[model samples]
Target: METYRGEPAFNLKGLAAMAATLLIWTGFLLSLRSGSQSVLTTTDLALMRFGLPALLFMPLLLLRWPRIRRIRLRHALLLMLGGLPFFYLIALGSHYAPAAHAGALVPGTAPLFVTGLAVVVFGEPLPRQRLVGLGVIVAGVGVLLGSGLVDLASGYWRGHLAFLGASLLWACYTVALRILGIGALEATALLCAGSLAGLLLLLAGGQVDSNLATAGWPLLWPYLLTQGLGAGIVGGFTYGVAIGALGAEKTAALGSITPALAAVAALFLLGEPLSAGGLAGVLTITLGVLLASGLRWPRREVQPAPAREPD
Candidate 1:
């Protein structure tokens, strides 16, 4: 066990949890990209993303219903930023861009967006290092968008924009979490339940397409495991555990490699080749995330000598 401030910093359990989180996050991008390649629609992917988690969390939602009902509509809407709308953008992005772009743009740039949100919404002061990190992130994103522009016919820029939108929405969700004053599990349940309702409404109105029936079990089971169980349930739980054990700054720093991992995995697993520009973007964004997160090793405190002259 590593200690910080006389308490456990990074223990085996926390490290294991962080590892699980990284795997799930990588799997999430791959799964969404795979679904986009298949007959499944964004609506179908959205269903998989929340359906099982919502079902499993139903009882918990009911238990917390009284408190939940008291929440303001504004906060409720903010919380939903992480739900259907976010997923819809991400799924739409997958249709146009390779998983590598998403790997670079979504999670890679989330901290930048979150920092912007914090400064804007909460009036927090931006530190110089994080400011520089944000600038670097912008440069990296420019490279990514420029890469997409090389083949305008592919319409990859549209996907890149959607991924950025998803990142912003996720940032909003992160800000909302601070003000919402709810446990992680409760928030997850609330968002999933609400998103599930919206999904049903959208389905009923024919606002989105669905291919769950046509896709069959071959497509559906993997999604259920990756989207619902792995990303939705396990990832969130493990992230919370990691945060508790390693603290948020270190956990975020460790998690920043998700884009690089996803990009490499997609190269082999999904047969998506990373262009030089995309590779540069991923590496740059990874460095930016580390800087933006202000990750630093804990320094031992030096104790001052007692007043010997008084004796």
Candidate 2:
């Protein structure tokens, strides 16, 4: 990977990606609130669970129309397969677990999974400092888990496990992006394509059906629009841009921010109380991510690499 010159700037794309991430974080909270409220019906939940992803990604299918002849079947299959478990696990887990717990657990563990995958699959080196940072992050997560906000015996364990499964699946997808060299747009498009396909299969199997009539446009539309636009389109694009700019490892490292952002959104929007332990864990994780990324306070001098010998 090529390193860009100077400090990383908050450019338009970067800003957009961050904004999209924030929106997605907010959307998760909103969805949870909506689920709690009588505002959402079973059908509305169904739409959120599946319909939104399909609608959000519908635009990407058009890319196959003109310039692009045919998407590589193998790549598309990989992306589709990688996304399936994540979508299902998250959708199921959110129903059982608190949004705050889900947010804290899922994104927090993602970077670690990515780091492990990089070492195992890509043979990428992990420096000692980065390993220590990873340890700190793990410790922070342990604190969050031990906070007693979630009940271990009351089926919440299943939800937490689901979120962990989804995190691992997402990590695999992240690694696939690097190994297959899929660009942001292409990867996003393929994920949408795969999601759409999986959703269709589920519907065909009589697992899910269109219930717009019972769902009503009032509740259904907002949920779908928010999830489809915010998480589906914008989230995909911003993440892609970030991946393009920062590479998979660094972009994945930035994922630690998602939980913090979600926590902040919950605090104000949902009036959720934050525990002292949670706050400390969040701060510790943030610091750990910065350290793992090798981002120092002041800019450091770059040492020149040894000259290569002629073959």
Candidate 3:
């Protein structure tokens, strides 16, 4: 790809892609919170997250099936580890923690994890701007959740830990997508297909579909659309493009906006009140994302050679 002197096409594309990912992710948390209150179970949500997308992307998988099959088991496992299991962990974690914890911890931890992994795995520079931005983002999350943390029960910590694990897995996913040179569409299709197998196994093991059974389809349909398509399919592919375009650190750092945006959404739509701390958190996170992403100080991106096909 050709480059401009200050702003480049890739940077612009990455920002657009990252923004879309943030929007979908914020909606995802909102959907999960709504489902927690409604009849949607983890299994129900998991199936939606994987099932429809699997069908939607089936053609891509079919066309690429022969090459996909040739992927080494470890590589396949790494790819699979990114999508379904990451979502499942967050869903499971919510059983113990409040929205504050999930919203704050999971995304807040992801940038740092991504940065660390990028350093160790890809040997990317640990830029000072990134460090400062990560610190600010962490502080923002603290503001967002500090009060909520005081009243946590024993089990909540488990959920907190799970959120941390989810963050780690997400970082791994981002790095793998970039280093492995997987195309956004290709990764989304393969991961969604793999997710289907996991969900089917759970179904075979007697997972209850009580939500789908008892709740009328009307209540669940909207969520299914959002979870199935927005967060499940589009979110993965867009994030992949971002990692490839923006590099892992900046892309992951941009994710800090998710909690702030989610909080803003809850405030307006759900009538949730934000404390002073929450307001500060929203501001801090926004500024942190700006600093981390270098949106203001845009740089020319060095384009990589064409992505190599997995043998």
Candidate 4:
């Protein structure tokens, strides 16, 4: 086992990764908020959700076209199926739920799901400390929601369910990444391909369209820029890199901070008030994450082996 340590460089990279993840999510929230302000055509929403992913990934596909072509059809289908529900849920659920609530809940439960899946599917050991950590994090999220921390009372239960469903889909995606032997670059490319397929499905189902005139170029710009570039392209690439370097467990552990960060962003950007319950929840979640990452306690001391007599 690779024991965890406070390596300054790795820590710095972890922080950067967290920041990038937070920024990506923040951008998504901002775009979603903006999109909701007006009448959104299906095309506009699809473009906002997938345009950047497609554009950013195009060059990667071109560069590795032969390799991309060589990917097995079944594996490609699996990736597409895994990615579709996640994107669809977010797009639909945001219409009914508060962005802050969705933000807090999605990332908050993801680590727990990942941990559980690891144990069940991979036969990974469930350390007691990690379990405690997961409990603490869940308690924090409960406090955050139960106390109207993000005004979650305004959302319907159905919307919350949708977000949970989305999280599960995402968990499946993460696990698939591990099982499928998909590297960071290839995973990213596959994600883009999957997203495109989903978008096409949405279109086929009459859930979206491609006419830019209905959405208007002006109103569509922010969604395209933020969702496409900030969230889809840059965010996906950064997260893929983080997962590659840190492994899924630690990467997901580090991601536990995203909800708290989203809460902070909501306070500043969306003028959402920071309540006492919210603060407590943030603390609880943070502590939980520290515990889950095996960082709360002091490192074990390694005693040197006794000096041996000359052989």
Give the best candidate by TM-score: 3
Shift of residue 237 alpha carbon in model 1, Å = 3.4
Each prediction's RMSD over C-alphas, in Å, is: 5.4, 6.9, 8.8, 5.2
TM-score of each: 0.85, 0.79, 0.87, 0.82
Clash number for candidate 3: 0
- Scored by lDDT, the top model is 3
Whichever of 2 and 4 has more lDDT, that candidate is 4
- Quickly count the clashes in candidate 2: 0
Residue 109, candidate 3: alpha-carbon lDDT? 74
Q: Which residue pairs does candidate 2 place in steric collision?
A: none
If ranked by TM-score, best first, what sequence of candidates would result? 3, 1, 4, 2
lDDT of 1 at 45: 77
Q: What is the C-alpha lDDT profile of model 4 across 1-311, one tens digit per residue?
A: 21222112244455566568767877776566556556875346656566667766777777877766776666566556445567667666666766666766777788888787787766678789888988898898887666443455565465677777877776666655555555666777777766776677777898765656665677777777777777777777677666655556666766777667777887887786768888888889889888876643245699999999998
Q: In angstroms, give how far residue 198 of model 1 lies from its true place.
A: 0.8
Query: Candidate 1 lDDT (Cα, whole model)?
Result: 0.76
Tens digit of lDDT per residue, candidate 3, span 183-221? 788888888888888878777888645467777878878
Q: Which 10 consecutive residues of model 1 have the lowest summed lDDT? A: 1-10
Query: What TM-score does candidate 3 get on C-alpha atoms?
Result: 0.87
Sequence-dependent TM-score of model 2: 0.79
Winner of 2 and 3 under lDDT: 3
